[model samples]
Target: MFYERFTFRLIFKLLFINALGWLLIYLILKTKLWFTIAGLSFILITSVYTLYSYINQIRSDIKRFILAIKTRDHTLNFKNKSTKGSFPDLYNSFDDIIKTHKDIQLEQDAMFQLIRTILQQVPVGVIVVKDVKDDAEQMEIAFFNEAAATLLNVPAYKYWHRLKQHLPVFTAEIAHIRKGGKRFLELKIQDKLIQLSTEVIPLNLYGADYTIISFQNIKDEIEQKEIEAWNRLIGVISHEILNSITPISSLSDTVNSMVANKEYLNKEDLEDLKPALQTIKRRSEGLLGFVKDYRLIAELPTPELEFHSIGGILQHIHVLMQPFAAAKNIRLQVGQTSSKITVNVDLKLVEQALINLVTNSIYSLEDTENPLIEIDYRLEQNKLFIDVADNGKGIEPEVLEKIFVPFFTTRKNGSGIGLTITRNIMKMHYGSLEVSSVPGEKTIFSLVFNYV
Candidate 1:
């Protein structure tokens, strides 16, 4: 009803303007009078001007609304809110439109600032750039974070050419892989050697090509890891050497005392000497075995890569170890798998790793009531995992931590190098060997093929 009333008012205004227009024209054509015509002409001009002003008000308001948005001036407002006011809906709509646009702009600005703050605060150096010329050397740096400057020990560079001059060798490596990849670089900074781990990523955002280079100074991290590795190796080696030498040292002194008191051994003395000699022989052999294991773990060979069906490999291991499990009355279950599932890995190395895991499971089941070992494959997040799981007395948490540490063992006569050698083999194949165990329920050792 309100809109109908407004439409009616517009019609009335148009009719009034038309009537006055005809009247003024008729007076000019019929009378052509001097004083009366002048007075009537003035009224005609006033009526036409009023009509134009009334219609033009809407057009003028539209122009003002657009100008407010163009200039981003939020202060501009339509004051009339009552239904009685002219074009009340138009005024209300303008206010709502401005508010919506203002909110959208605010949200975009806030998001951009949040990302900027995060990138600036991160420890990894970052730089986003776009190629201005054919070569990457002539590039424009779009985003250079604070970490970039700090890690390089240089001022923020806005162009690739400027940065190239500052760190020529580092820049060269970056140029080599403008597409995308990762590498570790050795560099000298202020007469000190540092290792830098760097990566590049290429992207096309909103029809513009961009490259983001992220790097970090990993010298301290690498050095710290090396120190920890040395400490572990030395500690294990020392412990093993002492364990063998302690018994032999004490036995040697007793045997020597016996010899010093006698010219030759009588039957009683000879029997005593035999057992002591046997102990010395056993300990000497144990020490020699430990050295061989040390060499095996330290000198792991590079994996020979080949694509092999996962089902085939698992099937082979089952056939080979079935007898060993059968002897202990344990079930060796190989899970059903897809024939198409395969991985790029060394056949011998992977088989060896599985054998080690299965052997450990077999040993764990010696005292358990109903023992079972399950071999299976799982696909997760674009990677394949081959698992050897067992239901036996599982590994304890304290021992699990050191299970991969070379020469660290929980069982008597355990060389303890099996797991370490297995882990090294997976590393050579760009994969990983992982374990998880519950105290009394289950233990799972996964040989994860990550790169494949």
Candidate 2:
């Protein structure tokens, strides 16, 4: 409809001009006057020029509108001055289209800003990667947040090829994640455990497919779960053993008292019964002590958190263990990396934990020549660590895994609860105990405190 309207108007203007030209020609021919011809010629030329200028003006307006749209200059407005013609409506249409496009562009920009803000604020590490189609070994890191760089220990704008050199474990894990159906994994980097979850979005965004990877630190969560399981098991075992042992202890005492009384048995009967009764009494008492240790494990008190000087704590431990160390001619020494270091912990519990580690070290050094037990405290990466190191016969690998289990002990007379209690104490303080040993060389037990 618009095309037809424009074409009809153009044809009418051409026909009117043609008629005017014919009139001018007839007047010139009939009058045989040069003045009349000149006047008509001027009028005809003026009319033709006016028509050309009007068409050129419309062409200029169209070119300006195209340029404004191409440049995204939505502020440009086309004014309709001629209210009597279709040019007015054409100008109005152009203005409306430009306004609509401006609104759409503003909305899109706002949406993009919102998305970027959300991605930046999220705690979990996120990285978006796009696989290259032709180059199998090349992958582009399209986006990565601050947490991603910190967690991977790599630059935020690194390609997969370079990232592999910095974090081979992470790159290898991510490669396996790209294979279908594996979305979660636990990776250890720089002695810190990280839990990773990946999602392959399979998005055809701007003609490419991309994958989004996410990472969470779940080490604390796993440790909490293990602690809960240990508590429950200890609770049940302690309850049952106490119930059985209490009655046996009482009965053994009663039987022994009766056996001691002459009226309770004859001489021969007394001789045979006394040893058996003594055995029963001894075993029941031992069982009672064992149950008590398990109960302690199950009912470990919550830490009374307070900040104490690391130097003071280590000095106390060294003094307390000196006599025992000297009895075996073993040298026990304590030192610190810094004199002003402090730790937040339960004083009694943390001391006990350290005592257990030091005692274990002392015991391990009994047979070695020039046996030494070195106790030292140091600050590393904002963490406080107390190490009990010994040049002793270190633990075997097979025994190391079960060392923390309750009632698992290598020493014949050990109650087997010392290390277990130490571990529990560390956990109560939101800390951890780590041990490293080399057979016939050295053993180091580190009590790591995360408190500032």
How do all models score by TM-score? 0.76, 0.48
lDDT (Cα) of model 1: 0.86
lDDT of 2 by residue, 324-380 (tens): 999989999888634666788899998899889988888888779999999997778
Residue 449 lDDT, candidate 2, scale 0-100: 82
In model 1, which regions exceed 4 Å deviation?
1-88, 129-140, 159-191, 196-215, 261-271, 339-342
Instruction: Note the residue pairs that clash in candidate 2.
Output: none
After superposition on all C-alphas, the RMSD of every candidate to the true structure, in Å, is: 5.1, 18.6
Model 2 regions lying over 4 Å from their true place: 1-264
lDDT of 2 at 250: 71
Q: Candidate 2: lDDT of 235?
A: 67
Model 1 / residue 340 / CA error / Å: 2.7
